[model samples]
Structure formats: structure tokens, C-alpha cells
Target: MLENKVALVTGAGRGIGREMALMMAAHGAKVVVNDPGVSLEGKDETDGPANEVVRDIKAAGGDAVADYGSVSDSASAKAMVTRAMDTFGKIDVVVNNAGILRDVIFHKMTDEDWDSVIKVHLYGSYYVSRAAAEHFRKQESGTFVHMTSTSGLVGNPGQANYSAAKMGIIGLSKSLALDMAKFNVRSNCISPFAWSRMIGSIPNTPDQEERLKSLRMLTPDKIAPVAVFLASDDSKEVNGQIFAVRGNEVFLMSQPRPLRSVHRSEGWTPETLRDHMLPTLKPSFIPLHMSRDVFSWTPV
Candidate 1:
């Protein structure tokens, strides 16, 4: 369905990004596989990972090229977009799937921990998207498939930095969608629960071991077709939306909506708010529960 399209997938070396790159290629996109080959914690880099994936695509009779550039850098990200235009002559999709994990409680979270995660997940998405956004706007068309997380959607402890970054992408995606809607450019994000190197590193509680197994069942491949769909013309009218994917399940996440409200023609003081408005609004407060509590079910 994406034939003749060119797609740039960041962090395409491994995990979900790899699957997305492969799937996009199999569906006839000339894929640009951009991976700096960093470990989960954002340390070290290599060339082999990106090259291996590029090789796999070629072996499968798909067209692809390896890009060893960090998405956290705008110049490098622009280079990825340039590679696509130079290689395939036009860009159709850009998937910001590259990310790193630095799990630590807020109390113990260092400047480095917070900064690194933000640099990768948040700024990485931004720099890459910004680079592609310019191109998309100029061309009057393009698609952005960004990666968000359940940690950000619901609330996960010990991932303040990661969650904050992921959630920030949701806001960014919405703004981009609104800003680019006039240009026929669409932007969307996916909160994927998949077993990858990043999720595997999280220290699961004893009760979560079985949940981890379920995560394994919801592998990265399950999330790839969704990327392809958003990138293709199939999602022409879909924009500024957040979706959650697990196994065979695809959920449309609740957008921020009004739960309750109160008004006083005479206006109100903190005293009035505390005595009346707070109580009126308390019943509608959404509880912050971990996704596991919400999405637990038999896996496909």
C-alpha cells in the first residue's frame, strides 16, 4: 500500500524500530534505517546493528539503506531525511522510534539520568520531527509515527524522566498535528507495550513476571502495521491521536476532556473552592493506576 514511498525510521537497529523498518520495507517503502547503535542506557555505539538490519531488508528483496546517526542531533536527523530524499528522491514517512532507558526513582534520579532520557526520548523525537516537519510542510504532505509509552499515559513510578519525556511527545504530537493539518500532514503517537531490550531491563516485581511473559507475547511486530497504516494514505484523516497497542488489542486512548466544572457568577475564593468545588469535582477524578491493572488480560 506504501509503494514508491520513502520512510525514515530512527533507532531502526533493534527492537520495535527494527520491526517497523522491516514491515515498512516489506510493504514497499524505500526504508532509511537510522540507528546510532547505542545500548539501552544510551552508552556506546556501533555500526553493526544498523548494517545488519539493512542487510536483512535487502535479503528479503526490499530496498533499504543504513544510517548511523543519532536522532538526538538535529543535524544528524536532517541528514536522515536528506538520505531519504537523495536515495528515493522523496520522503513519505518519518518514524521517530529511537529511544533509550534509564530507570531510576525520582529521589535517586540524577541530572544525567533525567537529562539523558529527555535528550533521547523527548528531544530525539523533537529534533527528528522538526527536521522532517520542515520537509513535510514544504512538500505539503508527510506522516509522523512517534513512540509514546503507557508509563506516560497512566503513571509509572521510577520512570519520572522517561514518563515525562514520553508524555511530552503526546503534547508535541498534538501541537504538530494542529499546526500541520492545513498542509495535509498528519502526526500521531503510539503507546506500545512490547517486550524489547528497553522493557526487558525494567526490574519486574514477582507478580509481574507472568505479566512480563505476556509482554513477550505482545512482541514489537504487532506494533509495526499500525506504523505502516499511519504512514500510508489510509490514515489521511486521522491526526493528533494517541493509541495503545498490546497483542491483538488496539485501544483509542481517552483524550483530555472535561470531567466536571463549577461556576459562580460572583466568582469564588480558595475557601469556596475548598468547600464546594473540590468536593463537586472529587467524584470525577481519574485514579492513576498502572496500565497492568487496566490492560491485564489473556494475551494473543
Candidate 2:
């Protein structure tokens, strides 16, 4: 579906990024596998996952190249994009799949942890997307697939840093979708619950793993096709949306709820607040899908 298109994927050395790069290549895109060969905590290593994916792509008769640039660094991100242009002359898709997890409670989360997670996930997407947007604008057509997380949507304990970064991508994707609409550049975010090194360490028994495997709910490959669709012409009209992909289930998430006024007329008194505000302030819940009557107080 992506014949003659050039695609760049960060964190493509292994896991979902690797699968996404391979899937795009299999669909006829000339892929650029960008991975810093890092661990889950952003520590650098000498692994060749990026090179290996490129080799796999070439072995499958698809075009691919390897890039060991860190997506968090502006210069490295620029270089990665430059490599795609240098290798294929034009960039048609960019997958910001590079991310890191620094799990910690709000009290225990240090400044370093917060900054590092933000740098890798939030700023990484920003740097890479900004660099690619220039090229996509020139072409007047491009796709940006950002790898977000369910943790961002449903706040997970002990993952404040990670959740904040992931949620920021949602906002960034939405704004970019609107800003780049005129240029035919589509931006979308995907929250994938896949079995990767990041999730492997999350206290799971062999039986649990077997059960999940049987259910087919946590494989990285299962998430790749959705990403491929987003990167292909199939999703040309889909923009500013956040999707959750896990096994056979694909969830179209809702936007953040706008603040609502409970009682504006007779406010400010403690007694009035106790009687009126407390009762009137209904829990604002956002529905998963868009509907004509969004403000209805009915249960789904």
C-alpha cells in the first residue's frame, strides 16, 4: 500500500518500533530503522537491533537502512531525517516510536527522572516531528504515527513521569493534526499495550503470561498493522485522534473533558458550596466515541 514511499521509525531496533518498521517495509515502503540501542531506562548499549531490522528488511527484498541516532537529541533527530532524505530523496512517513520509562510515584519521582522521560518521549516526538514536518510540508503529504501509552489515558500509579510524557504527546498530536491539515500531513497517536521489554518486567507469572498469550492480547506484532494503516493512505482522512490497540481490540479514545460550571449564580459561600456545589458537581466522564449529544447525563 505504501509503494515507493519512504518511512522513518525511531526505536526501531526492537519491540513495537521494530515491528512497525518491518511492517511498513513489507508494505513497500523504504524504511529507515532508527534506534539508539538503549535499555528501557534510556541507558545506551551496543545492541544491533536497528541493524538487524534493516538486514531483515533487505533479506525480505524490501529496502531499508539503519540509523543509530537518539531521537531525544535535536541534532540526532535532524540527522535521522536527513538520512531518510539522503537514502530515498523524500520522506513519506515518520513513526515516533522511541520512548523510555522511568517509573516512580509522584513523591519519589526525581527531577532527573521527570526530565529524562520528558526528553525521550515528549521532546523526542517534538524534535523528530518538527524536523520531519519541514520535509512533509514540502511534499504536501506525510504521515506521523506517535507511540503513546494507556498509562497516559488512565493514570497508572508509580508511572507519573511516563504518564505525563505520554499524555503530552496526545495534545501535541491533536494540535499538529489541525496545524498540518492544510498541508495534507496527518498526525495521530496510538496507545499500544504490547508485550515488550518495558512490560516484561511488570511482575507477571508464567501462568499469567501463558494466559495472556493464549488470549493473544500482548504481542508487539498485533500492534503493527494498525500503525501501518495509520502510515498508509488508508488513514488519510483520520487525524487528531488517539487510538488504543491491543490484540483484536482497537479503542478510539475520547478527548479530554472541558471544565464545566456547576453553579455560577450563587457561589462563594461555604454553606452554599456545601449544599449546591457538592451536589451539582457531577463527575464529568468522557465517552469513548464521539456522539451527537455529548452533554447528556445518561449512562452508555
Candidate 3:
């Protein structure tokens, strides 16, 4: 589907990112696999993972190259794009799958926890997309498939930083879609439910552990097909959409929409809002719950 194209996939060292890199290459996209090889918490980095993925692609008779650069830095991100263009002539697709986890309940969350997650997930996404958008603007064509999370779309305890960053990705993709639509540049995000190292390493209760065994059926490979579709012309008209992929099921998530409104002849006072608007809007409000709670079905 992506023959004659070149793609750069950040966080391609392991998990979903690694699978995405391989899938794109299999589909005939020369891939630039970028991975700093950082641990789950973004420490103890190495180059082995990225090199191994590149080797695997080559062994599979696919085309790929290793890029040992962290996506968190704007300069490094620009260099990643340059490598793709330099190696394969031009970049047609970019997958922002790089991320880190710093999970902690809000009150107990340290500054380091919050900052690290935002840096990698939010700022890193921006750096890559910003670099790609510039090149895409010049070429007048490009596609971006960014990674989001159900934790962000719904809610997840102990993931304030991650949830916030992931949600930011959705907004970023949406606005980018609107801004670059005229240029034929496309952007979309996927909120994936997959069993990856990040999830495996996080502490879980007995129930979560049991649930995760089921969730494992929705492996990273299952999510890669969605990324491929988004990257290819198959999704040419599918910009700014958020897709939730769980096992064999794919869901189109609804964006925020107004449900109810209360207007007065004059401006609304706090008391008036409390008495009138609250009652009118209460029925329309969706209850806040953890993402897993909202989608508690067994993985199919």
C-alpha cells in the first residue's frame, strides 16, 4: 500500500513502535526507525534495539535504516527527517509512536514524573510533527499517524501526565489537520489498547493482571494495521479522526459535541447557572471513569 514511499517512525525500538516500523517496511515503505532505546522511564538508553529492528526489516526483505536519536529534541527530530530524505530521497509518512510513562497519582506525582512524561509524549510529538509539517508543506503532500491513548480520551487514575499529553496529541493532530488540509497534508491519531512493555511494566492489581491477560490478545501487531491504513492512500480522506483499536475491533471515537445549553435573556449569573444551567446540563454530562471501565468488554 505504501510502495515508493519513505516513512519515519519514532520510538521504533520496541512494542507498538517496533511493529509499526516493520509493518510499514513490509508494505514497501523505506522506513527510518528512530529509537533512543530508552527504558520505560526513559533511562538506561542503548542503541541495540533500533539496530535490531533495522536488521529484522532487512532480513524480511524489507527496507529500513536505524536512527538512534531521541524524538524529544526538536533538532534531533529535524535530523531524523533529513536522514529519511537523504537516505530515500523524500519522506511521505511519519508515525509519532515514541513515548514514555511516568505514572503516579496526582498528589504524589513529582515534578520529574510530570515533566518527563510531557517532554517525551507531548513535546516530542510536537518536535517530530513540526519538522515533518515543514517538509510536507514544501512537497505539498505527507501523512502523519500519531499515537494517542484511551487513558486520555476517557480517564485513567495515576496518569495525569500521560493522559494530559495524549489528549494534547489529539488536539494537535486535529488542528494540524485543519491547518494543513489546503496543502494536502493529513494528520490523524490512534488511541490504542495494546499489551506492550509499558503496560506490562506498570504495577497492576490482580484484576488488572487478569484483564491484561485478555488484553494481550490485542497485541501490538493488531494496532499496526491501523497505522498502515492511516499512512497509506487508503485513508486519504480520513484526516483528524481518532480511532480506538482493541483486538479485532476498531472503533471510531466521537469528538466532543455539545449536548445541552441554557441561555438567558441576559448574561448568566453564578446563581442562575447553578439553578438553571446545571439542571439542564446535568442529564447530558457523561460520568467520569477510568478508560478501562468505560470499555470493559472482553477482548475479542
For candidate 1, what is the lDDT?
0.90
TM-scores, each model vs. reference: 0.97, 0.89, 0.98
Global lDDT scores for all candidate models:
0.90, 0.85, 0.91
**Which segments of candidate 2 are over 4 A away from where they belong?**
203-217, 259-261, 266-271, 283-300
| Candidate number with the higher lDDT (2 or 3) | 3
lDDT of 3 by residue, 207-239 (tens): 687788887787899989999999998899899
Q: Which structure is stronger by lDDT: 1 or 3?
A: 3
Error of 2 at 210 (Å): 9.2
**Candidate 1: regions farther than 4 A off:** none
Best by lDDT: 3
Model 1 earns a TM-score of: 0.97
Descending-lDDT candidate ranking: 3, 1, 2
Worst 10 residues of 3 by lDDT: 201-210
Which tens-of-lDDT digit does each residue in 79-191 have in candidate 2?
99999999999999999999888777689879999999899999999999999999999889999999887677876567778888988999899989999999999999998
Model 2: worst 10 consecutive residues (lDDT sum): 290-299
